[model samples]
Target: MSRNAKINTLLLVLVAALAVLPLAFGLGDHKEEPFTGADAEAETAITEIDPDYEPWFSPLYEPPSGEIESALFALQAAVGAGVLTYYFGLRRGRRQGEARALARLRAEADADAGDEAASERRRV
Candidate 1:
């Protein structure tokens, strides 16, 4: 068989091995343990503001309803959408560039073939 065929076969075997290995040895998983202690001190270890520190700026805007959780969810959604759109757009642009390069290569090869054919006719 050709070198490329051997390479592809090797790659296929590697992918198959990767796929089956997880199933052969039972899939690894983490088990959650129930909370043990009623530790109020551990729970209340949040950072406290100093009484001596004066406010630098006045609050200009009021947050949306259920601000803490809702705002975080909204921010996460917006960021996720932005990142996904950017990633896909970048990929699409790269695909278009590759297609154009392939077309140019095909055109150049066609032009070279025509020139060779014309030279052959001239020689004949």
Candidate 2:
């Protein structure tokens, strides 16, 4: 395989290892609830540290179930990622377009200079 292919393969393998290693060894299996979000953990820690602590404000809409909540969280992440992807893609496309336009302008200028040079050669 080519060098790039080898590197890509190695990276994919590394990612697979990272994703599976935790599950294989049951890293969070000791917990009563596996894959709990940081918000739940933070709430637990705050309540333990100060039972009288109050939140500045509560969310206007809470999901009915953990599954729905997870779906909404995933949706939010996907939307944010899509926005970032679109913005970056647009920027890259504009840059490439500008580069192409510059190259075409240079080519046209070079052609015009070459024609002028040929005309001067004929006069001499």
Every model's TM-score: 0.40, 0.62
lDDT of 1 by residue, 37-113 (tens): 34633433322335455557866855556677578888999999999999999999999999999999999999999
lDDT of each: 0.77, 0.96
Count: clashes, candidate 2: 0
What TM-score does candidate 1 reach?
0.40
Off by over 4 Å in 1: 1-73
Worst 10 residues of 1 by lDDT: 29-38
Error of model 1, residue 76, in angstroms: 3.0
The lowest-lDDT stretch of 10 consecutive residues in candidate 2 is 31-40
Q: Any runs in candidate 2 off by more than 4 Å, and if so which?
A: 1-20, 42-59
User: 106 in model 1: Cα distance from truth in Å?
Assistant: 1.2
